[model samples]
Target chain A: MDIIASKLFFTGIDIGSTMSKAAVVDAEGVMLGYVIGPTGAEHRRRANMVMEDVLAKCGVSLDEIAYIISTGYGRVNVPFADKQVTELTCHARGVAALFPDVRTAIDIGGQDAKVLKIKNGKLVDFLTNDKCAAGTGRFLEVAAETLGLELNEMGRISLQSDTPVKINSLCTIFAQQEIIASLSEGKPLPDILAGVYIAIATRVVKLARQLKVEPPVVFTGGVAKNGGMVKAIEAVLGMPVSVPPEPLITGCLGAAILARDEAFKLINRGEYKLQKKQLSEAYIEFTEKTR
Target chain B: MSGYYLGIDIGSVGSKAVVIDGSRIISSAVIPSGTNYATTSAAVKAEVLKLAGLKEGDITASAATGIGGRNAGAGSYHSVILCDARGVNLTFPAARSIIDIGGQGSQLTSINETGQVIDFSVSEICATGSARLLQVVARILQIGIEEIGPLSMKAVRPSNFSTSCTVFLETEVITRISQGDKPADILAGIHRSIAEKISGMARGVALNPEVAVIGGGALDIGLILAIEEKLGMKALVPENPRIIAALGAALIARG
Candidate 1:
């Protein structure tokens, strides 16, 4: 797959804890294609397959691609990429690419959640909760398993609750017991579910506030799709939140766009000649020591 | 004539009484382990008599099990027996694993072929069990205990409240309420959440297909369904799910 060399096509790959997303962009910041897949068995293997698949679909050939930039927890494993970026940088860049007017970005991923503040498309400061899977996507998945609801359906179910249930505990175990006790006493199901959404949103708000949220703030990541969570967050911040279309794939797209820019720079330097094998080795070395 | 045996299991949250005639369980009783054992025992005795149509002298043998079992005194005797004897045959032969979900915590006990405890596991902390969650639901819904089960089934899309900790879950529930959600759905969500937690332990010991559920929470149909949903298997609720522990103790005494 190849695109005309009129404008450089950058490719960004973000391999997260639960999902992998890839984005391709032109010099003008136009997203070529945003693709996603489950983070498969191994870091490198899944990243390779997903990247190839996404690139193939967009008709963007490896030869046409300028520079490849990898980001996220699994960044080091992008076997064929030229460079790797931190999740913080990638998230800020990804959000800024979409809503350049925004200075604050909050991303809730699978195993970890983060809040970042960006200035002029550069990440200025950020806060991340990597301790447990409590407020992240995994916690909601576990909760969904318990409730016998599909992960996609929780948002809709929460909307039906008439009187929201109140859960004061922040610890997952105690909150479950509190919920169980409430169930035994004959509380409504919707209310209890509503309480749970509120709890998660509260955690997100706390993290966002720590970074000093600015208007034109963007909410990105898998958790942003949860309607109940969004509503709770909106209530807490007293502001309307913006969630990019296909929020999960934004980080990857940003990485891809960055790759395009690097490729143009390589061309300008007349240093665009390197074996794929050498490129892979250098990328791996940088990732191994990026942290 | 069939000799009537009585077994009482006093746990952290509540007490259970099971009356057995030979190999058959005539009836059972379940009451909260509120303030003291005197009142709990008396309440159990009254319930057993009411169900079995017999008085104290009719009970040929009696045994006790659970956390409060040792504390239960018959106005004089103060020794709690293990109640793992191989006497009064269990009515349900498939009940080899006994899970007690009490007020304070939960315990998983492996029962031998003869209804004796082979190994048991208990939660380490002092936390609210199914009873407390039930109370929250009751308070939120303003409905009787009998209503939650039927109403929970009505939810088309059940809310998923996540948590493995009882204390943390309380705060989560409160957050949900503040977010403009209803009480019934929250109750249903809580039921499923706890079922998942309890099932995690049950899965640890290779939960047999015909596992028996015992505890005050088991009385709630919603909780039972939640367990079934999470385990992907049907659960066997004893004649009186809450009293199974006490009844098991009684069976031990009879043997």
Candidate 2:
């Protein structure tokens, strides 16, 4: 009943470890709106709320969306989704939509860092940090905590430093100790910040190198928004990197694009069926399965 | 010969100074190492001297060990791996393998019959294997450091913790707390993780029998139990676990 009637829309939700995001696109694969919010403890609840918010922002109701997809670490927790896809695949699709020439994509999420090899906008090979927090966004979060500075401040301050110090510890906890020691020894904040970025870049690039990274590398994820991180990765990788606008919404955007493609395919085949979305039923099923 | 030999361990979490007379531990002191070396070493030194009823001048020779051991003002400094081996041999003569969980790092050392280090492994990748996590957990739980070990024994089933990365683990622990997981179960899981890391670092070196667990990690009864369950053996612990390295440094100074 809430359908726009004139146009068909596609919806995508990404329930990441740290944040939940949702995006809506028209049949032309143009993003109308996106919303990113804290995932919190209840993933299923957050996913639904985010979808509602994004739809409201786009002036489209859930009824207008032809297909919906979920992605990211908590993708499986989304019961209302028609399909679930991996963040890696969603990211590749999203990046290829933005940078058509992207051969490599690096996505550093809160819990993990991934170096994905992309061929023709499709994921080919990838490498991720092996259960180590060495090369992740959480490392920067700890540095921010230790320095008593905001996360945004790290990138801006690090730009001023011409000489960056080396961080010896691979672990974020021990790196905090090293940072404390540096602060006591009168090391400048900018130098330390630069060093921290370089440390993350080094670890991530090490993973990227193993994949035999090619040119036209694209960086995405919340960490990609930090200018210093991009510069550090570029310096370590000895190549420049491009970033998409609104870095956090890539997975959701990709999901929405995929939703659009799937819906169009069904429409072309005359096999399209208006999905009977039973949120309550899905929630009950989820609870029963979990129990 | 009548005077004492001193050994100081300037560790990241705590500093310890031991006074000994020909391998007989006369006195020792441990004080929290807050930020840097100067204050902690000074406090530990004064406390040990007070315990021995002697002034700093009364020490004949002194050696230092541990992360910040260089600033201990000792005549010589030794590696923590060597100190652990020497101290373990003295405490448990049959001990050929040692796991020392210190503030900054958890180390596993393989030793010969005479306490010479055959090989050593430091959890080089991260501090997840270290004792620092216990302090952080203690602060989060708002409990005394001594209470965590005993309280962990009460866990009916230790909670499963997937990641040992302290940064990730802290958030996970907080979530567990919010999700109404019992603190005892969380602590038990943490102890088990530390045990696993120590064992993980001992991958290449084949551990000889009569393994000993020393340093700060050995002080925790719950951790010992978890480690015992993990290794399937009874691990030896000295009377005063924290002072082993300082004791080894002192024994070295005596020679």
Candidate 3:
């Protein structure tokens, strides 16, 4: 009926290989709430959980949300999503929105890594290494587990190393062995961690170098939170890189922004009823499956 | 009387020693290489000597091979490629190609009719499909490495593991386990993955029959079957697959 008078919100969920993140935004492009957690076995169930969690945090009701966009590896499995967008586009948009001058966006996720070349606030070219997890968060997780350190502590601890050990293995499995061998040799923990960060940074930089990478690079994804990795990357690139405030939510935020834009366009065209009906049907199907 | 010959293979993961009098293996021992290669080499040699009930001085000549071959205190050293070729040929004279999957690496070698290595490809850069990868998977499954082969053989539906990187495979295994996939299926998937990797390495070498699979990984019956399936032909495996390299080393020492 009077759809124009009602306040509309959008939700975006990114069900990554290791973690799932959700973001809620109002029609005006302001982020209201966000939530992130480990992506468990069932991707569909995890997506729904994250959606509910973010909505609850924002004190928003499911009915008030106008659109929901899903991205990442499990994007297609999001039962209640109105649209499924590719993570590459979402990441580029998210980083561009944060840093308008960013020419390159480096996203290192749990299972893969991507390098995007942005020109004039749009993605021009991109390269990805989905074939392996050598430079991704999974590598760091394994390294941290092998070193008996928390994943979050790797960056800080690595900064304390005076003489960083050289990690020659490009494979994550062999890297774990190398790290273990270093530990048994009584090498300093900080040095070993430094080596791990440098190895990952070297891999990411190699991916970035394949493209025409210019300065003003933006780092996104879960791994970007590691200061040691950022420093290592900067050292290799010979340029400073900027990181978003909440690097983990960049993809989800971009998806939410897209959802908000698409919903406003529909509302403006007076086609709100069709969008609402589709979401309700999808939501019903998701509930039935969960039950 | 024929003289005794000693063969020591000080690999990255394990050290193997074989003592042979003439063509018959008198005694053999395998122990973890541990942190100290020299110490493990000495320990393995002593254990082999004890098993044979003979003193070190009784050995006429000794040869070593593997990652720690030079540092293992052997009288002579032979390349792993040469050792693998000679060792497999001794057991299966028709074997023209050998696939070796060790703890830290893997290799596929094609040999001439004379048991000399003609061409070889190694998996040193990535530990995937190596014995160490299986050991890591076993640790994650909380089962012994020996259990993987038997369990995998009973797989009703083996899962497909697309990633060849060992690090990614570990995560894949964890994800599969969490999804309530059967351990047998997971183990079978790992064997198949290893099989595909070894096959890829073998494709570079001109593999001619009889192809023999050796090294610590050959102990896994599931892997042997997978390799056979991948290559579209049967593969020969010696009775004591792990001791082939040591035996080859001993043969080299005899000369």
Q: Which residue segments of model 1 deviate by more than 4 Å?
A: A1-4, A269-291, B1-255
Q: Give a tens-digit lDDT track for model 2, residues B1-255.
A: 667999899887778889998757899999877555656678899999999999988899999998778766789999998888877888889998998989868888899999998888887756778888888788778898899999999998888887777767865776677567899999998998988887788787667788888888788899999888888888888878999999889888887
Candidate 2 TM-score over all chains jointly: 0.75
Candidate 1 local lDDT, B224-250, one digit each (tens) = 888788878887775566666566566
A1-291, model 2: which lDDT tens digit per residue?
A: 113213678898998878899999887888998999987766778888998899889998776677899998788878888899988889888888888899999999887899989999888988887577778998898789767789987899999898898898867877877876776566898998999999999999999999999999999999999999999999999999998888888899999999889866755554554343433333233223433
> Which pairs, if any, clash in model 3?
none
Per-residue lDDT for A251-290 in model 1, tens only?
A: 8877876676666565445455442343433333332333
Best by TM-score: 3
Candidate 3 lDDT over residue span A1-291, tens digit each: 223323667888998988999998876778898999998767778888999899999998998787989999889879899999998888887788788898999999998999999987778899999777788888898888766678898899999987889998777877777776676566888999988888888898999999978989998889899998888888888899999989999899889988888776765566655666745443343333433
Report how far residue B242 has shifted in candidate 1, in Å.
14
Q: Model 2 in CAPRI terms: which quality?
A: acceptable
Query: What is the C-alpha DockQ of each candidate?
Result: 0.07, 0.31, 0.31
Q: Report how far residue B47 has shifted in candidate 3, in Å.
A: 7.6
TM-score (chain A) of candidate 1?
0.87
TM-score between predicted and true chain B, model 1: 0.80
